[model samples]
Target: MTMQIRFEMPSDEALLLKDMAERFVADHYSLAQRSRMLAAPATELPAHWPRMADLGWLGAALPEACGGLGLSPQQVLPLIEVLGAGLVLEPVTPATLQCATVIARLLPEDRASDVLAPILAGQQIEVLVAGPDGMEPAVSARPVPGGWELSGTVRLVPGGAAAAAFWVAVDIDGAAVLRVPAAEAEVTAYRLLDGQAAASVCFDGVLCPPDACWTGARAALDAGAEMALFGALAETSGLVAALLRATLDHVKLREQFGRPIGRFQTVQHRLADMYICREEVRSMVQLAAEAMAGEASDKRRRLLSAAKVKTGDCARAVVRDAIQFHGGMGMTDELAVGHMVKRLLVLGQAGGTRAGHLTAFSAAS
Candidate 1:
């Protein structure tokens, strides 16, 4: 039999989480609320953040031993997709899955708990500025009398303004990670194109105790990167689906020649193309999920890179076509399509540029 790729049916737990997330979005995360949040300072956490924690969202992906639910990657993918459809503002996956994975699996048990507890409770955040940038991991570090002195500037770190600590990758004989508290760095806070909180963090001879460093964190870094890739792909796929649905509804209601545009042959063709784009992305997300389930290897990296690259192209295609179908209304800031398009624009380039990921894919191959 020929091979087939499809979205696996979500587990009961994932279905439960997905329903909860949809309910949460419907009950609280309205388009109006999103607009208001966009108008506010990006550094101020959204009002619904604590509620996400209270609903067990923050601890959903972490292991019970690490103060998390320890759900599998597939089990959590639907929740991310649903949140993406709603355009939820919180960095739930990164703060919960990616950041927590690094902190819990790499740091000392006691220290990890200390850092992760507040994060899981929505009381604090920690971020890595180099997320999805695919840059050469760089944070200059040297042994000092009392500890290590680090010097480097990481720019445009998402969530950095509110982060309590930063997981900065350093080259010490090999790849390593330093858990530096946000207080130790000079952070210049700003907002991204998609209205996410961001900052440029600089370390000038910042001292760190030996206990704060995790040597040979290349594995930890790889694991974190995998989770980040999975979350981005899944979330963007959700956005693609939502945009497709919105565009479909618009076409059916829009009129041309005294008839619904969706009934016309041209609009029908466009909608079909958009639907195909959506399905392509959905398939790639499934591939990402499967790749994440396996071991961290060159093959896994290559597959994730391919999915990332494909997801970027398809997200843009759907958004561009959706805009075209909306007759310029999609471009208006007041519309959800406008905001979704902007977010997709950011996601399309933020994690890994097409060229960057292309190079990565080539190397992996």
Candidate 2:
């Protein structure tokens, strides 16, 4: 007798959104367009930002009360994966998922709507400065009668150059987060190896009103960090999948020893290994996404760290193998593999390095 295994599928809405994202990428995000986007001024996003807003992609993860579809992290995973496959250079992960989530969840109620509305509409960009330096209760804040003067530097802020504002963490008496206008800070912008924009923002006596600051933002920061980590995992999954497909295509087309290189037993074994790595990454991303939806913070952190470490490992292996299979051509900019490899390197270091996550996982246990 034969047995059948059944699994749950994504909702119709999720499937529709995934298909729309894939179609959007196929039509709008060609390699040339990606290059143009990278070369454009740091303050400008690609021309498609407004179009993405129109498609409700920008607001997909926000709560419905915040003018979004309120999609869960899991539901948004497929769309992120699609973006990854196309190597989309937009700051959707940093700006929307991480920064927006923090603002919506922790910002003062009176300030939330005004700040988030423009972001969801794609009219403004906000970046989070909550990495190690930003998280440290070290950014000095001095009382200046009605408001506080902030003086510190936040390094390696993703999407910082184009950001209209920043959710900056600071220390008054304890940990607090301040919403500071980008104009107030000295933003030194540069391109990451993956063609993404990053900046080091220095706030030398930047004044911030009391209303612009929120105290005890650690919980919110944790939530945003987890979301960012999940976004990286999702994108890495898509990148690995893309690399696998490209590798398979290359093996089938490249000739060696009077036949397709794919016919070689060793090549077939490598291809199989790549596929295995891709699936492992996908599974871990799904696990992390599911964990994020639950209320248990400890469990969520543990699982997210596990996912980050596994995804980084798999991404490294898959990219190395894909490049090897493609020979010298893989390292050239002419092919997508090299770009994907750079992105994998960036992603590995973005949320937290594999060693960092491993330590976190061990501590969590």
Candidate 3:
């Protein structure tokens, strides 16, 4: 019999992680906490970082040799799911997993140890570039006395403002992925809606030794895209879950015409539909994660695109219904629904907009 993919409960270990994460969010981070953290100086997330490290979450996916638990992708999925439910913010979602996967798959063997070690150890913060929308390179890299000088623009780098370094792709003369130092490169930063920091980097006469150059730019980009898709799926899953819970809560006590609004057939049907959509989106995300873990490249790509399209549609629909169900209060920032909708909308378009993905899917087929 073929093994079925279970989208619901995870293993004991995953459950333990989930419980710990949920408790942490309850104790240390509510929506108020999120707002406070965002307003704080340095926007430093120190409290969260150490707690995550202590929980061994920082090293969840890396190999044992690199100070990680070496868990399979299946194991990591639950942890991310729990994070989604809690609406937690940490670099592990996109920055660590995506960057670490790129290093493991694309970087030279000699470089893997160097790159993954610090990340697993939680000593280094590496940011990945999403695209080149608003960035401009200052210096061009060319053969030098003993190394190379990199000059150019890398824009919309996630976590770039605080990154120790960046996994940058350069259109070297025409192409290459260059591992460059954030300290050496000048970067301008902007805040994302979800309170994450991103920046545009300008490289001005930055010196990169021969050791800094890595082959497999195209492969890394492809892998990065997949990683990003999964991250987005994970985040969307969180938003939908939050919406469901809030809507359920509102329905329970919200009275209309001498009965709870939830008692009405219409209200129940809307909620049931929302629940089904959320569950379906969850299944698609899980399938995409499985395909990625198996290294089924073509299958992974197709599944990721499919998940994005479906999830995007579902998110838009679910949030719209949620707002209508909750009435005007749902649209206010004080409530979680509005913020969740904003995030879902941004993420839906982040990796590749729905229209863009559809076009790509058509072209590929």
C-alpha lDDT score of every prediction, in listed order: 0.80, 0.83, 0.71
**Greater-lDDT candidate between 1 and 2:** 2
Which one is best on TM-score?
2
Per-residue accuracy of model 3 over 67-133 as CA lDDT, tens digit each = 6677666667777766765656567755666777666667656568778766666666776654521
List runs of model 2 lying over 4 Å from the truth: 1-8, 108-110, 132-138
Q: Write the per-residue lDDT of candidate 2 for residues 109-189, one digit (tens) a residue.
A: 556777888888888789888655224543578889889998888768888888899888777677778888998889998
Best by lDDT: 2
Stretches of candidate 3 above 4 Å error? 1-9, 41-46, 108-111, 130-142, 172-175
Deviation (Å) of 42 in candidate 1 = 2.4
The TM-score values for the models, in the order shown, are 0.93, 0.94, 0.88
Error of 1 at 250 (Å): 0.3
Better of 1 and 3 by lDDT: 1
Worst 10 residues of 2 by lDDT: 1-10
> Which window of 10 residues has the lowest lDDT sum in candidate 3?
130-139
